[model samples]
Target: METSKVIHAIYTDDDVLMAAVKKVKANKYHIGEIYTPFPVHGLDKAMGLAPTRLAITAFLYGCVGLIVATVMMNYIMIEDWPQDIGGKPSFSYIENMPAFVPIMFELTVFFSAHLMVITFYLRSRMWPFKDAENPDPRTTDDHFLMEIPVSGNEKELHDLLVETGAVEVNLVNNTH
Candidate 1:
């Protein structure tokens, strides 16, 4: 694949980064990516990203967990091995549902937590032994990096980024 040139704008503070993002968007420049040491509030809106649907997936996973717990408990305690407890031999699941509430709640929470993590990892293309995609290591510590694609106007973009409180600006040829 052919390599593409991108401009990397480094910022020291997240507030300056946020304002720069807004200014860049207002000027009709397509931002490629932004790397930050921590999550910045309202940054997604500024970047024009769509809302996440992870909560809906989590709810569906929790529902699946609840159904699995209910069915497993009913099969084990009622169908396969019905035991006499508290002088009652009622082999019905409804009558014993109160005793299974804790299990159901725990399984729901467990499934939601685990499945959400897996989903997030897969969606973000993260896996064990994967190479890091960050261009600057400082972005993981104290600096924020913003990437903008170069479309034959490198000097103009560079000057604009420098005017927007960027500490340093570098042109990078990214090859994947």
Candidate 2:
């Protein structure tokens, strides 16, 4: 566990942060976490993180929404109480599919958007009314913080971080 002697390297420029991340990985240090004010391009790749699968999950969610919309429309329009919608006799779903196209598209996008957000939140362990786990409030505004666990080479890590243009480097000792 990364429970003690973690170094919090703070950087002001994203480019410097990116360079520091690459150099740190090259040196084979395990990075615990990183917080940034905004999303940095290619930062995940620099940190050697695995690619996310959220896009695939969103596609599956969209398919479910389309299926739900199709079944709901068929039941409501054609089976339970058939109505002559738009002056056309509604006997089959395929016959009146043109009118339902808008509803189907809207539902598809709606489910994909809403469910994707929920999935991201759950995947990131962010739940309703959860207390913030941010280590530094300045990271939310204009600073970037890289957390590296100090495993018996504190002096070396401190020197490397200072060489990598860190504005401030603080060693945080956890009580647990």
Candidate 3:
């Protein structure tokens, strides 16, 4: 089966591009993606993207890290080798928490970073050693791009894009 053709419009000014995106979204057209050299504030909302839950995922992962660290440290220091060092009580977790702090912090950071990366990769459909899908090469270098899949009628979409002050309008093809 053939994929739908993607029509892309490149804009130089981010403000005008954002306005155009808002108009497109208001008109109920499906936006394939938007690429900008730098992040345009509120662009996700303009694109009607659902709010991300990455922060929540990170928090849960961090909690897991804390639990693992606490359990491991308690088992090793308190249970396995119960030696009172530095005039501190080995049996009291509350008293020995200061010693466990560094490891706890390290584990928290490790889990949060790893989990966030994995979540991003899964959400973006990217995998290790997989090439990234780039729609336009120049978009990575100082270009603001908006891409939309073409429906049966393209004249209005083209006119709207042109009127919205697109510097260049072009079609991207998957077929080589």
Candidate 4:
């Protein structure tokens, strides 16, 4: 199996990392990955990443929750134990909807928040008990790491990275 080389460019400050990301994109070098201690503002834009679809999924999940809440409430209140309470008819789901509105809203928010998180974990391939994929440990603390594939152009990439104020640059064998 052939092994490819990747350059790990370490940056101390987020501002310098942002500049490096933009410069690398302008030079048409594809960035493999980046690790930061915290979320960097506009890093996705700098890397030209597409907007996430999490919001769409969250909306869909919320709809599902609403449906589930409606059906469950209908079954429990109207079909199973229909009664008149407080001079109001409980036999009809529509007439009793006001009481269920709070429940439906709560379920919607609950489902959206929880399912969105689960979807993110699944999409990111972040399984339970999985080992961390970060190359440098410092990236989880104070440093930021940008990984760029070395496609027979290590010298030029290294120079550009250094010029971009990379604190350390390393060429490491990466096997897929």
Best by TM-score: 1
Off by over 4 Å in 1: none
Across 122-169, the per-residue lDDT of candidate 2 in tens digits comes to: 999999999888899999999999999887899999999999999999
lDDT-best of 3 and 4:
4
Instruction: List pairs with backbone clashes in candidate 1.
Output: none
Q: Where is the poorest 10-residue window by lDDT in model 1?
A: 82-91
Model 4, span 55-89: residue lDDT tens: 99999999999999999999999999887888887
Positional deviation of 58 in candidate 4, in angstroms? 0.2
**Candidate 4 residue-wise lDDT at 114:** 94
Ranking by TM-score: 1, 4, 2, 3
For model 1, residues 1-176, the per-residue Cα lDDT tens digits are: 78999999999999999999999999999999999999999999999999999999999999999999999999999999899988878579999899899999999999999999999999999999999999999999999999999989999899999999999999999886
Worst 10 residues of 4 by lDDT: 83-92
Give the C-alpha lDDT of model 2: 0.94
For each predicted model, how many residue pairs clash, with residues at least 3 apart or on different chains? 0, 0, 0, 0
